[model samples]
Target: MNALLIGAVLISFSSVMVVLAGLPPEVTGFYRLTGGGMAMLLVLARAGKLKLFTPNTIKWGCVAAVFFAGDFVFWHRSIAFVGPGLSTMLGNFQVIPLAVVSALFFKERMPARMYAAILLALGGLYLMVGVSWSGFSADYRLGVSYGLVTACFYALYMLSLKYALSKDRVDALVLASAAALVSGLILGGLALAEGQSFVIPTLKSLAAISALAFICHAVGWFLVTRGIQTVRGALVGLLLLLQPTLSFLWDILFFGKPVNPVELSGVGLALIGIYIGSYTKRKKRTQ
Candidate 1:
């Protein structure tokens, strides 16, 4: 639980780091992945856990990498389009798709409370982004679209990761490190193809990127993966919500993104809805 709390808070700084770095989307993703991957690799080597990568681990790690790649590309683009808060919130919308998948494939029961929660989340989104979506500039709309796309890929990544963790017996560090390295390679190629430089020109940008890699990616993900293994699914969702919620607040505090009453209300509704949707009553033990 402490791991989840700390990890969520740490990762919530991701958008702020990206904003501070002020680099191209792919560039930021590249450095984040590669640098964090290397850091994790070193940690694994030091701990002598580098031998834990099995065939199953590699396969699932590759799968996670692909989905993460898509997520990073679209999510960073969305961040460029909209501010961090809204973009992060939009990405966290993965819960909607994930729930639908659960119902369809896993045969999970969706009660009325869950349904209401979904509607609330959607209503909140409508207030935040949908209401003015058409009236907004082309870039903004495009950002919103990318954000939704991000949610899809993020759902896929979560599914793959959860499966990998449950079935593969792979250490979380091994999976995370390998996936980050692979995704970094993919993004690195894309960055080069798009003519983006790998150079960090300013020390400030370097510091931000370093913090992003070591703090947010390496430490944050390690703690999160550990916590997710122990925490219940619904509770995990509620705890992880801290990431976007704090991220939105950070955007307001740091980025000076303008927020109106309608938008604030929307955020509240969406957050409440998400919590309600994810809440599950514990069943009493049978004698």
Candidate 2:
């Protein structure tokens, strides 16, 4: 499979896998990262490339992990206040922050067409979530606030990971392992402080959590990190629309959610935007 396709499939599974794990958010996050980290460590050791703890690697890896852990915590909490669909849609606002950061810090030039593509993708995402603007409760407002915070941390994580990958000394395996290790440690500590049990409640839950760790966290994110090395940060954000879009389809198919025509149309628009964004070429600077 192509890198984009791999990334799309992996990310699409992430939310669903979290739900299937059926644990408290912090505990789920901890296991997912720990399991993934251990798996990556085994892979690195087998390949005789485990010597990946250089100063630059440690610095950027920990930075990315911290942001990722924050993103996970806020987003999972938002899901309790708001429904997952709306929370996910709001969390995806990371694209805006990512675009701004890229322009200011990375100095990566964006084309006009790219901006149009981003707008189209976001519009489609808004529609896909079927957002209701009419009602606002305190809880819902709090959830929205949390979701927005999740977006900021998520954007930072992506940017940090991109920067880490750009260094010659860092590879995808090491970065993924380091991120998972640090995130797991931080989240595990939070889970304990919250008095959440670390033990899996059932064999079924254990299986699900293991799948999340190995498949979604280890394999899925590994491919995504590798893919982002070739793809731009802004474009990667646009491409991740596939995750929520697919998650919507899963809900409709398995969870007995009523299908809406408007939302279906939103899926079409999101796909079109992804295509446009993927193909849009940056104009070359004339020296």
Candidate 3:
């Protein structure tokens, strides 16, 4: 639980890191993945686990990577427009789609409470984005859209990575390394297409991005994955709420963003809805 809490906090810093790095989204994504991949590779090689990369692992990792890259692109873009706190909160909507996918494909049963929870979450989201009959600004709407798209991509990444890890044949480090490498290559191409420079302009920017990669992606996610193994899925979902809550705090503390009371209320409601939606009923034992 402690590790999971630490991982959640570390993951929350990613959006702040991107904002602080002050680089184009594509470039930021590329550098982050490349650095994290290299670090993971080194760690895996040192542990003699490089030989555990099977073909299935590579294929699934690449698939996960593509989704991850898409998530990063949209998330960073949304951050620029909507601010980190709202964007992070919006991105966490992946849980809704994840639930839908599971129910559709895996025959997972969702109780009535889950449906109510979903509605509450959607309402909360509407409030968070300041959407109403009066209408929202175009930029705010676009940012909201991007953040939702990010959730979709992140859902796909999580599902694919979960499947890959379930195989148990490949080391977690190898899979992470492969995913990062593939994400880096894809984002590099995107950067070129967008006419963004690949070069790091300043040492500060480089250090910021490097820390994002090493600390957020490599170490944070590693801790998360490890902690997930020992925690219940429902509990994990609840713990993940910390990421966005802390992200909101960082946005205010570090970026001097103003607090919106309505939005903060929405965040609280959405988090409650997520907790309710993620609730898993345990079966009763018969004596």
Candidate 4:
């Protein structure tokens, strides 16, 4: 049930990202996050769950801003370089680091059997790219680099948010809202420095980014936080594997992406990993 909900959220973002692929990176960055942040903020404010912004809240929130900003900028750039499917797969690798850090620092643990899941997930990502490594052209190379960077930044965002959520430092909704505003301002500056237009984004692009924010950032994070409180750390990590899976499906239907044998096998491996990680952990917990 929890897994299904996460998968549904993943599918929503997958479709949204396909739409966002056509927008300017900076514009895409702001719209993809800010609306959802505002929505969450509104709920928090009305509920009086909105905590006062503290120095520490500002610190972590600002860091989240930078990471969120960096993640989108580089991810959008990666899509421009590599195709969406490959970029999404690589960016999704942040799950590996998240699982590891949660185990080390947050005491999120699973049984020995869970190790196999990581390998399967990585294998899936490798296969998703066809594992050819042949066409490492300047664009592809740069895209890969940026994709990995996006993963790193995303991992940081996850960790920071996890800390904030655990501490109840501020309302999650408030934190999200402030982070988006900060990130929007930062990206707005970068767009200015790059001579990109910031005034009016296209209607199509606005719609795409609106879906990205409301569905992806706001809903995804909201449910993930709630789900994580109930599920195991490894299970939570594995559940997110849905994002890349559904994102690839969107690439095929929307962008005319065709899966080769290698790619299919790779995606299979990723799904297997998720099953191994999540199911095995669940069984261990039961035992």
Candidate 5:
């Protein structure tokens, strides 16, 4: 539980890092992937686990990489336009699409709670943006759009990665590094085409990027994954909620994101909805 708490806290800093880096979204994503990838690769090398890169691993890793690249692009753009709190919250909308996919393809039946959860979340979103929809800046609207795009891409990435992990005999760490490096290369190509410089301007930005790589990606996720393995299923959902919840708070505290009573209520409502949707009920066995 301590690991999970610390991990969530570190993950919450992800948007803070992106904001502080002050780089283009692609550039920020490039650094995050390459830096974190190389670090994880080194660990795998030290552990003599580099041989785990089966052909199956590479194939699925590439597939997952493509979706993740899309996720990074739109999510970073959303962060730039809307600030971290709302953008991160919007990304959590992945649950809706994921639930739909589960029902349609996997033939899994969603509980009544999921329908109510979706309504609650959408209602909260309406409060956040729909109320002042006409008055919002073009960039704000685009940010929200990018955020929803991020959710779709994020959901696809999660599904592909989950399938790979479940079916392949690859080490989780190896697959992660491969996906990161591949995605980083894709973003690198895009960055070059856009004529963006790889040169990070300030030392402060470098530090932020470094933290994004090592702390948020490498260490924080590692801890969260470890915690998930040992923790109860119900607790895992609640514990993981800490990441986006703190992210919203961090934006308010650090970036001075303006919020009113209604928006605040919306945040609370949306978070509750997300939590409810995220929780999977475990069935009991008959004796």
Candidate 6:
């Protein structure tokens, strides 16, 4: 039930992020993340759950900041090269890398049935993005590259979080605050260096971005961290599928983007794979 709730929240957050992709990715990432983190900080302070930063918390937070920085940098560039839809789908392919990273570094294991499910999920991923192959050679190649970088860096971030959680029982808000500070300073500098002007957002965009900050960056990321504390990295990778699937839905409903047979088939397979993966694992635990 917790997993399902986390999945639902992640899907909603993914929809929000895709919409915000129109903004300069770096500046938008900074504001959305920093604002959201700040809001949580306030909540933590009010509740007196916020913890003081020891060397350990700060150390883990900074490591996570590196991967976070990489994800924003690369994934945003992916959106610029590929259209938002394909960019999103491809960027999400990082689940493969994440699972590998977990298995290798963290020795994270899963039931054999769940491992089979992972392969099916990857095959589904291929189908999901393969539809855009028509007249999409150059852009597709670049998008795949950017997306792969995003995935690899994300794995690093996931592993770092796992390490941090293993070390201490810090508040989610505290870790978020630390990450926001480090990520913001690094990415903010890059944005300035690139001359990506931080223009004032229009009313609509501001409202949208604010929702993004609170719902996606803050709440969504927090849930992700929470899930990582209990679930293995491979499982977290499967769950990240929520991002693209939800983004696809948003495109359909809000943007009026139509889907065809190929896309639907791909989505169907991916959903089935996720179901299979989760079920296989759950069945084992119950046994």
lDDT of 3 by residue, 41-122 (tens): 8888888888788888899888989999999999999999888887998888887987898789868787788788888889
**What's the true lDDT of residue 107 in model 4?**
93
Candidate 5 lDDT over 1-287, as tens digits, reads 88887888899899999999999989899999998888888888899988888888888889989999999999999999999998999998888888888788878899999999899989888888888889889999999999989988988888888778877656787888889999999999899999988899999999999999998988887788778767777888888888888999999999999988888888788888888888886556479
TM-score of candidate 3 to 2 decimals: 0.90
Model 2: per-residue lDDT, tens digit, 57-141?
A: 8778789899999999998888677655546655766766777788889898877866886888678766755364345577877
Off by over 4 Å in 4: 1-7, 14-21, 99-114, 167-170, 223-239, 274-287
Better of 3 and 6 by TM-score: 3
What are the RMSDs of all candidates, in order? Answer: 2.7, 4.2, 3.0, 4.1, 2.1, 4.3
Q: After superposition, how far is residue 214 of candidate 4 from its true place, in Å?
A: 3.2
Error of 1 at 169 (Å): 3.4
Candidate 6, run of 10 with poorest lDDT:
278-287
User: Which should have the higher TM-score, number 2 or number 4?
Assistant: 2
In candidate 6, which residue ranges exceed 4 Å CA deviation?
A: 1-21, 81-86, 109-111, 131-134, 222-243, 274-287
The alpha-carbon deviation from the true structure for residue 196 of candidate 4, after best TM-score superposition, in angstroms, is 1.6
| lDDT for each residue of candidate 4 in 1-287, tens digit (9 for 90 to 100) | 48446745554464446456466788767665667677777767787766666677777789788888888788888877776776777777776766777788889875665677788887877776537667557777788888888887888786888788677657666677778878877887887888887554567666666667777777776776567557765656556666676776777777787668887888778777755654523344443
Indicate the residue-level lDDT of 109 in model 4.
79
Off by over 4 Å in 5: 282-287
Give per-residue CA lDDT, model 6, range 217-236, as digits (tens): 76776666566557654565
**Clash counts for the predictions, in order:** 0, 0, 0, 0, 0, 0
TM-score each candidate: 0.90, 0.81, 0.90, 0.79, 0.95, 0.79
**Could you give candidate 1's per-residue lDDT for residues 1-287 as a string of tens digits?**
88998999999999899988989889999999999999999988899988787777888889999999999999999998898888898898887887887788878788888788889999999999877777899999999999989998988887778778777667777988888988998898899999998889899999999999999999998899889777787788789889999999999999899999999999989998878866666555589
Once model 3 is optimally superposed onto the true structure by TM-score, how far is the C-alpha of residue 125 displaced, in angstroms?
A: 0.5
Q: In candidate 4, how many Å is residue 200 off?
A: 3.6
Q: What is the lDDT of every predicted structure here?
A: 0.88, 0.76, 0.85, 0.71, 0.88, 0.67
